[model samples]
Target: MTIRRILIANRGEIAVRIVRTCQRLGIVTVLAASEADLDSQAARLADQTICIGPPKSSASYLSVDAVVGAALAAKVDAIHPGYGFLSENQRLAQACSAVGIIFIGPTEAQLDAVGDKLKARSHALAAGLPVVPGGEVDSVEDARALAEKTGWPILIKAVSGGGGRGMKLVHEPDQLAATIELAMAEAHASFGDPRVYLERYVASGRHVEVQVLGDGENVIHLGTRDCSIQRRYQKLVEEAPAPNLRDGLRADMHCAAITFAKHLEYRGLGTVELLVDCERDTFYFLEMNARIQVEHPVTEAICGLDLVAEQIAVAEGKPLRLTQDDVHLTGHAIECRINAEDWTQDFRPSPGTVSRAVFPLGEGVRVDTHIQTGARVPPFYDSLLAKLIVHGTDRTQALERLRHALAQCVISGVSTNLPMHVELMQQEEFARGGVNTAYFPWFLENRATALRDQRVAKGN
Candidate 1:
C-alpha cells in the first residue's frame, strides 16, 4: 500500500526535505511544529499544519504525546521523525506503532538494542565487524582501569546522545575522572540518560560512514561518505566516495555496515559511522545513526536515488525497488552545511531575520533550504539554515563547483558558518584528503591565515 499522508515530526531543513518528496510522490504532508516554528517553511508549505506545543522542545518537539497527537489529529497514516529530536527514541517509535501509524524508521527493538553504544558494539562484533577499543565501564574505578589499559587520550561519550553533546576527550590519565564526570553530567542534562562509554580517540582518522537502506529482510548500502571535516564533533562538510579510500576498503566497510543492519533486521534509512585510521589501513565501527542523516543529500546526489522516497516506500512495507547490484554510486558529491552562526565568535548562534537570502542556482548545485529573505531564524531549534549540495564527475570538479556555488550564494542580517566552510574547502590538507579527525582542530590552531583569507573573500 502507498502512503496516503505522512506527518513530519521534526523541524528545519529535514522537514522541508520530506515535504518536497511527498509532494513529488503525490502524498499529502502534515507538518507538526513547535510554537517557534509555526512560521517555518514546513508549516507554510505543508497541506496541513498543527501547533504541537510551546517553543521549548520538551513541551513540543521532544514530547512524544504532542507528536503522536499531531499525527492522530492530522489523520495521517505514518510519522517521519526526521533526524535529531526524537528520531532515535525507541519509545516514540513504539508509540507510533501502538497507534497503528507507521514509524518511518527501524523497529523499536532495533532502536533499543543500538541506542546504547556499548551494546551496539557487541552487535557489530557479533556480526563480524571490527569494533572500537573500548566499551561500557561498569563503575568509576572500572572506567579508570579501562582508561589506563586503553591508554590515555580516550573519549568519554554519552551512548544515548548525538550531535556531539555529552562528549569529552581526555588527553591524560589525570583528566579521565573529571572528563567522565563532565560527560556524564552533560549526557544526563541533554538526553536525560547519564550512561557513558569509553573509546580510544584516534588522533588522526577519517570519519567514513556507510549509508544503508533496508526492508526488514534485505539491506543494501548506497555508498560511503567521508565526514572528516567537523568541529565539536558536528560535521560541517561531507562528500561521497570518500577521497583516497584504499582499494577494497569501501567494499569492506559497506559489507560490515550491511551485516550489522541485517543482523538487527533494520528497516528504512540508517547510517553506520566508522573511524578509519588511514595510516594503519584499518577501520573501526564508531556508532550507527538510526535515522536519515543531515548529509544524506550527498549520498543521493551521487547514487541517483531518492532516499526520502525510498524511506516512505519502506515504511509502507514496499520492497526497496533497487537491488544491491542496482545501487550504483557514481560521480562525486559534496555538501556544505550552511548554519546561522558566527564563525568569528567561536560559531555562536546568530538568530535573526534574514534580510536578503539568495541561493546559487547552476549545474550540479542543489540547495535544500527552508529559509527565505523574510524568515525569522528561531533560537528554539538547530541553527542549520540550509544545505548546499553539489555534484561532479570527480573530487576536483566537485570542489570547483562548491567554490563557485558558495561565491554566488548570499545571506544577510546574521553571521554564518559559511565563511568557515569556504575556508575548509580551500585548505591544502583537506584538498589532499586522507587526513584524520583531529585535522580540523589542528587546522583551527595552525591556519590563521586561511581564516583571514575567508573573511576577505566573504567581503568580496
Candidate 2:
C-alpha cells in the first residue's frame, strides 16, 4: 500500500509543510487551490497544481466535493487535508473512501466518534481518562440547570466546532441563557450543528496536549505541548514538553492519552488536549483533535520526528518506525504564530500583498509559511502568515532564541501581529513560564492601557 501521488486538499503553510515532506519521501504532490491561492508558495512548490474555484473557501478548500474532484482529476492516489478545513471532516474521509483514494488521516468512523465533543467525552470517561465535570445539554434550560450544579463561570462548548469558534463563557448564572443562545447560533453558523454542552470553566488552567500516533491497535505518545498562550480561545503560541510539568503528572497524561487512542482504535496522528490546574498539579481531558494540529512542529522539533511522514506511514498500514523506548524528547522548542492582523485594533484581519518578507534565519530557527515577498495573503482564509519555531537546549535558551528570531523577522504591506508577538516574548510572566490560559487577555488589556496612558502623557 505505498502512497505514490498525494493531493493536498488545503492551502497555505500546512500545504507547504505537507508538500515538503511528500517530496522528501519521493512522492509526487498535487496541490489544490482556489484562484486566490494559485500563486501561493505552496502552489509553486508542488509537483502539480489544480485550481478548483474562486477565492472563497466554500468554493474551493472547504468544498469536499471540489477537493475530491480535483484529486481524482489529478489522478492522485491519496488526499492529505492539511490541518484545517476538511482535515477533521469525516465527510471528506468518506468521500475519499468512496472513490478508492486513500485519505492520509483517520478513518471516517474514528473521526466521527472522536470529533463529536459529547460522544468523545463519554468515550474518554469510559476509557478511564479524567474529564472535566460536565454533561451534555439538550436545551438552553438544560444548560442552565447544569450550570446551577457545576457553579458559575461555566463553559458552553459546541459539539461540532473546534479552534474556539463555537464556545462562549458565562461568568454569572444570569448570563447563562444569553451565552447559550449565542453559542448555539455561532455553532450552527460555523459548524452546521448547533448542539452544545456544559463544562466547568478553569479560569487559570494551562492548555497542554499530547501528540500520539497509532496503527489501529497500538498507540505511542510524542510527549506534551503547552498551548496556554492564546487569544479568544485560539492558540497563538505553543511550546513542547510543557515547562514546570512534574514527571508524575506528565507520565499520567501520556498514559491516559495513549489509553484513549487505543480505546478508540485510532489510526494516524491525533492530539488529546487537557487542562492543567498548574497550582494544584491536576489535569483533566479538555477535548481530542482527530487530526494534525497547527502546533505539531513544536513536537517535531523536540522529538525529531516527521509527523506528516508518520501519518502517511500509518495510513499505509505500517507500524510506527519508532517505539516508546526509542522515542526521546530533547531540548525546548517554541512556536509563535505570525498572523495577518492589526493587533492594536481588536485584531482585525489585515490581509493584503506581501510587499516585503524576510523570515528569520540561522541555526535552530524554522519558518513554515506559504507567503513570499510578492505573495498576496487572501482574505478568505485564516489569518496565519507563518509559524516561527525555535529550538534550544533549555527553556531559557529557547525563549532567548524566539526573541531573537522574532526580532530578525521582517514583513510589510499588510499589518501583522508581529509587534504583539515581540511584546509577548518580553513579558515577565511568560518568561517565568507556567502562565495560565487567562494570561494573554490580561496582558493585552494591560498593554493597551499602558500605551494609552503614555499617549496621554505625551499630549499633556
Candidate 3:
C-alpha cells in the first residue's frame, strides 16, 4: 500500500526525522504526541499533530489501542514507529496490521522471534551464524553446570531486556545462584518476564553492529557502526565504518549479518549487533534491533543513503532500488548522543530549561535535535536531548571534526554530559581507537587526570 500519510508513534528527534523524510516524499505526516509533548519539536514539524493521551507512556506511546485510534482518527495509511518505546512491541505490530495500517517494519512473527534474546540466539545459531556461547538453563543446577563449562565470569541477562537493564555479571561460581535469582527478578520487573539466560562474557571486546536493509526477500548490509563507547549498556557515542578490522573481517561480518537476516526473511531496516573479541579475532552475534537505530545518520553520512526514505518505499511495496554491490561507503561518520544528564552524578537525569542552546554547524556537521532555546526538558521521557553527527574523509578527520563539534556544542540550565564527551574525544586511547566494552569503566577511573588536563588546556 502506498503511504500517502504516515502516523508517527513516537516523539523527539526521531519523530521529526520521519516527518522530514515523508515531507520530502510529498507525503503528509501525522504526529501523535502526549500531553507533555504537544509543544515539542516533532509536534511543530508534522503536517498534522494530535495529542494522544496523558504524560505517562502506558497511556500514550505504549498504548496500542490509543495509538491505532489516533492513526485512524487522522486517516493515516501507515505508522512509523521510531526506535524505543513501542518500536519492538510485537502486539503493536499486530494491532497495526489488524487496523489495516501499514506498520512500516518487520512482521509480528519476526518481532516475536527476535524480541527475546534466547530465542533469537537459537534461531541465529541454527541458521549457521556464530552466536554468543550461551542459552537458557532450565534449572539452577543446570545453570551452575553450564557456568562451570563456560568458565567463570558469565553474564546472566534477561531474555527481554533492553537499555542494559536486568543484566548482572557474576565472576565466580559461588555467586551464580544469587545473581541468577536477582537477574530473574529484575527481568520480571523490567519486561514482565522472569526468564534469564547465561552468556560467557567477552572482556575487552568491541561492540560493532552491521546495518541491514531488507524487504522480506532482498537483504543488504550497509557497512558497520562502532558502538563500543557506551556506559551501562547505553551508547553515548557511535561512528560508522568501525575504526579497525582485520583482513576480510568486514566482508565476513557483513555476510554473517545478511545470512542471519535472510534466514528470518526479515523486513525493513534493522541492526545486527556483534561482540568482536580482538584478542581472539572472532565475532559473536549479540542481538538484533528491528527498528531504525538512533545512530543511523552516521551510516547515511558514509553510504549517502536515506534509510528512512527506503523504509517508506519498502512499506509502499517498492523493491529495494539499490543492491548490495550498489552500496558504496565513503568517509567516516561519528555521532555523540547529547543527553540531559549530569555525568558527575552517576549520569543522573537532569531536566530543566535550556537557558542557552548553541549547536555546532558547518561543513560535515549535522545536528538532529528536538530541543530549542528556552525549551523545558521534560522529566517524563528519555534524557536524550540531541544527536551531534559529523562526517570526514577518514577516522583521523572524523575525530578532528568531532573535536570541533564537541567544542562548539553548548547547552546551559542543566548539567549535561557535554564535558565527558569533550574529554572522551581528546583522550589518547579513544583517538587511537583503542577501546572496547571495558573502555568506559577504565576511562571513568584512569582518565580523570587527562580529562582535567584537557579542561585546563581548553580554558587556557
TM-score between candidate 3 and the true structure:
0.96
lDDT of 3 by residue, 1-460 (tens): 7789899999988998998888888999989999999988898889889888999988998899889999999999999999998898999899888988999888999999899998899889987988777779777898998888887788888999998888989998888888888889999988999998889888878999999999899999999999999898999999989887874887889999999999999888999999998888989999999999999999999999899999888878888888988999999999999999999878999988999999988889999999888888889999999999999999899889899999999999988999999988888888888489899888897766777899999999
**Steric clashes per prediction:** 2, 0, 0
What stretches of model 2 exceed 4 Å from their correct place?
Answer: none
Q: Model 2: how far is 207 from its true place, Å?
A: 0.5
- Candidate 2 lDDT trough over 10 residues, lowest sum: 138-147
Q: How good is model 1 by TM-score?
A: 0.96
TM for candidate 2 is: 0.98
Residue pairs that clash (backbone atoms under 3 angstroms), model 2: none
Q: Model 2: per-residue lDDT, tens digit, 142-248?
A: 88888888887888889997889888988987788788889989999998999998898888799999999999987899999999999988999999989888899
Better model by TM-score: candidate 2 vs candidate 3: 2
List candidate 3 stretches off by more than 4 Å.
Answer: 448-460
lDDT ranking from best to worst?
Answer: 2, 3, 1
Write model 1 residue lDDT over 157-202, tens digit each, in one string.
9988787999888887777777788889999998888999898888
Model 2 residue 415 CA deviation (Å) reads: 0.5
What count of clashes does model 1 give? 2
Candidate with maximal lDDT: 2
Q: Model 3: which residue pairs collide?
A: none
